[model samples]
Target chain A: MNFPSKLIEDAVTEISRLPGIGKKTAVRLALHLLKQNEVVTEALALAITRMREEIKYCQTCHNISDDLTCSICKSHRRDRSIICVVEDIRDVLAIENTNQYQGLYHVLGGVISPIQGIGPEELKIESLITRVNKGEVSEIILALSATMEGDTTSFYLSRRLKDSGIKVSSIARGIPVGGELEFTDEVTLGRSILTRINYG
Target chain B: MNFPSKLIEDAVTEISRLPGIGKKTAVRLALHLLKQNEVVTEALALAITRMREEIKYCQTCHNISDDLTCSICKSHRRDRSIICVVEDIRDVLAIENTNQYQGLYHVLGGVISPIQGIGPEELKIESLITRVNKGEVSEIILALSATMEGDTTSFYLSRRLKDSGIKVSSIARGIPVGGELEFTDEVTLGRSILTRINYG
Candidate 1:
């Protein structure tokens, strides 16, 4: 598409670099910003630049933080003896929203995905090991996704921590709480049956 | 959602302010940026800021431009005796991409929409009239959309230009070029038959 202005073209090109946004959507967004108040654009630019430049990763858990250590890792009320390991900071947010877990979290950043050129070295596995080796943590909950990469990361971590004597457990994989039995996938249904709890 | 950092939350809020993007998508985009190199975020922020701050509007046509006058209005090859008016700058780009029209363009910025509290004064209607009154133009083509607001604006412009002794026309309305007749909507099909063109 021929842009009337080079500035708009450059803005659209930059915006379209983001995941899931196309050139058309980028154009729409750029035009929208143009229509809005200058403060709006300034605020957006400031927030993005500040977030990228100033945000830090927790030294202990590798989670995104404003300080050296994340709030979850620093909170005295959180169960320091149990660490929930996950693939991303968003996962930590999800589990935190559930309010069922009070444990500190270890953000792996991503899982072991060979297809995407991601391996154990690319993640925060060493930091997690160091955290576990401190011996204050008694159990490690593998709260990663159910994908193959998640499982591979879990297996790799378990093998590495086997000699350290700390218990390593994975989150359950079964039909969701409200899922219909007939509609559930075969593998999930089988796992649900295999891991069924005893009746009271 | 509980953001691990205030900066992330701020960035997400700003990003989600854009049309068609939600909080979840905003968070995803923010994280994607965080994962990328700092130059990516810097480039995006700089492009958006520069575009919003430095872009100019064509004094003659009201289209977006890098200078006082847009390239279309500045070009000597374009026909000065004709002007195709549109509702937005994107419309100008769309018509230009067709390569069929050699006339200059006038961007109205938007059509009249009372529901959105937009009035004729808010657009570039007065400037269009002023351009037509100069007597250099003999034809004014209304290339606005077929919506109610578009029609209202077209009618308003025609009324304003009725005594100017210039030909006022609108782009043909019918099914799209590649559209199938059987699946076309009744209103479009009816209009297509009513305004059938003569064969050469």
Candidate 2:
């Protein structure tokens, strides 16, 4: 059967690409956009466009930023001596929202998974090691997922940083198995951060 | 606590404006965009930008279109003599997906609701009457919602078109009350189309 016009079709297709948004949901969303005031729709579209055009990864923490260095990395209020390593920037936001974490972040971009063909070299692991070797960071917090890939990356990083004389730690066990840090509510994430344990 | 960066915060705020997307989902979507290849993220952003920049309404039917007339309205295969009136473009799509109706469409933009201050004047009722007055159309189908407002609009239109020497019909009653056409499965919508009844 023939569907909507090509423009509507394309909008729905793009919206469906987002996580958890199926075809029906995408169509609903697209129609809602069409129903909204032109200004709101324009703002939403412009936001997506600006995100791609203006935003870039922080050179130090790999978090999203409009400049070379993210605010967390540049801020004097944050403790640069403790870096919390995470698989993605979503984790950084999750932790930041809790208003608990005072240290800086190190987004690894991804975990090491041989099956998915992602390895240490593909991540920011080398940069992390270099940062640790600088002798400034006293604690490296592994806030990666509890998945097998996350476990592997954590072990590899711990072994590599063993002789760096810095304490290597992982966030606490309140996070459920296979649970994404993005899905964890702010309260649990804050509690997990406060009760972190030593990894080595 | 201090957040990651203003750029990340702004991107998340924009993403959250989408339906069903909360602050957390927005952050996840933004992070996913950040982790993706620049080309892919740029493509998604470009799609949104183009949606705002390129898409426009069909002057004839009011359905979303890139040109003056939507594809369905422009197509010679569609029966211009039978114009199906719907509440929105999404309804037009649902009807099209059935592959049963071969007629053109007229999108009303919304239904008449006294509570919401939406009246016949606010809808495309005037344009519909004008289209019918041209004498080329023989049947005008009301494929609007089954809500009270929908019924009110249908009754109002039926009264106005009583002497127009054209048949006014409505899609069947099987459509659940308050259920949006976008959510109705193809089969149910198709069946409703097949079971349409004369309104006036």
Candidate 3:
């Protein structure tokens, strides 16, 4: 079937590329964007552009930020001696929203997924090790997902840091199998944080 | 609760403004964007910017275009004498996808909704009348929604065009109540087009 103009089609295609967006939904969203006022559309565009141009991965935690270090790392109130390691930045937000954790974060960028060809080298594991080796951190919280990849990464990190005299603990098991922390409701995430158990 | 940095909050808030998006979903989407490659995020931003800066309403048909006039209006193959009246540009795209109607389009910008404070003057009805009065248009198809607002606009237009001796028709009644033409499958829309009835 003949589609709308190429520009419209292109915009739909790009929107569909976003996670959780399908082709039909993308078309609907693109049309909605077109229907909106020019100012709203421009704001959306600017948001996307600024996300790419202005934001960068924090050199220390790997969390997204507008500066060399993420706000959590730069904050004086956050305890630098306790590092909470996570699979991605969303986990950082999930942990932060609890208002429980006062420690700094270390975003792994992703877990060590063998099936997806991702290894420890592909992650921010090296940076995490380097930070731990600096000798000030007393606790390392493994806040990765409750999945095989997350388990593997946790095991690998614990083994690597076995002699570092640092306490390594994984966040608790209330998070469902195959469920992402980002999608889990805040209360459940809070409970998981409150009940975290020692790993190693 | 202490949230992530203000930048992260701002980004999520901006994403939530899109249709059907809520705070949680917006945060998920924004986090995804944050994790994505800079090139992809930049492209999304540029698309939004281009849509705002480049797109404009066609002076004649009121359909959105990147230039002075829409491609359909500028094309020589489309039937200029037959003007298909639609409620919005999305409807124009829906009809265009069918490839059955080669006629020109007249976007009302919206239907007549007295309760919502929309009136005949609020639509592009005057421009439609002016176009028909210029004497080139042979047929005007009222391809509006079957809702109360759409019916009111169709009735108003039919009465206005009655004395002009031009054939004014409303697209067939098989369209479901409160159903937008853009959401109807192509076959149904085409059938509705084929079964249009003459208006007084």
* DockQ scores for all predicted structures: 0.85, 0.41, 0.41
RMSD of 3: 6.6
CAPRI quality level assigned to candidate 3 from its DockQ score: acceptable
- What TM-scores do the predictions have? 0.95, 0.81, 0.81
| Residue-wise C-alpha lDDT for candidate 3, range B96-171, written one tens digit per residue | 8777899999999999898989988889989999999999999999999977788888999999999989999987
Candidate 3: segments with Cα more than 4 A from true spot: A1-9, A34-37, A174-200, B1-6, B175-200
lDDT of 2 by residue, B116-181 (tens): 998888888888888898889999898878778888988988899899979999877667889999
Determine which window of 10 residues in candidate 2 chain A has minimal summed lDDT.
A1-10
Residue A195 accuracy (lDDT) in model 1: 86
Q: What tens-digit string does per-residue lDDT give for candidate 1 at A1-200?
A: 88879999999999999999998899899999999999999999999999999999999998999999898888989988999999888898789899899999998989999999998999998988888888899999999888888889999999999999999999989999899999999999998899887899
Least lDDT summed over 10 consecutive residues: which range in candidate 1 chain B? Answer: B88-97
lDDT of 1 at A4: 78
lDDT of 1 by residue, B1-200 (tens): 88779999999999999999999999999999998999999999999999999999999998999999998899999899999999988898789889899999999989999999999999998899899989899999999999999999999999999999799999999999999999999999999999999998
Task: Itemize residue pairs with steric clashes in candidate 1.
Answer: none
Q: What is the interface RMSD of each candidate, in Å?
A: 0.8, 2.7, 2.5
Candidate 1 vs candidate 2: which has greater DockQ? 1
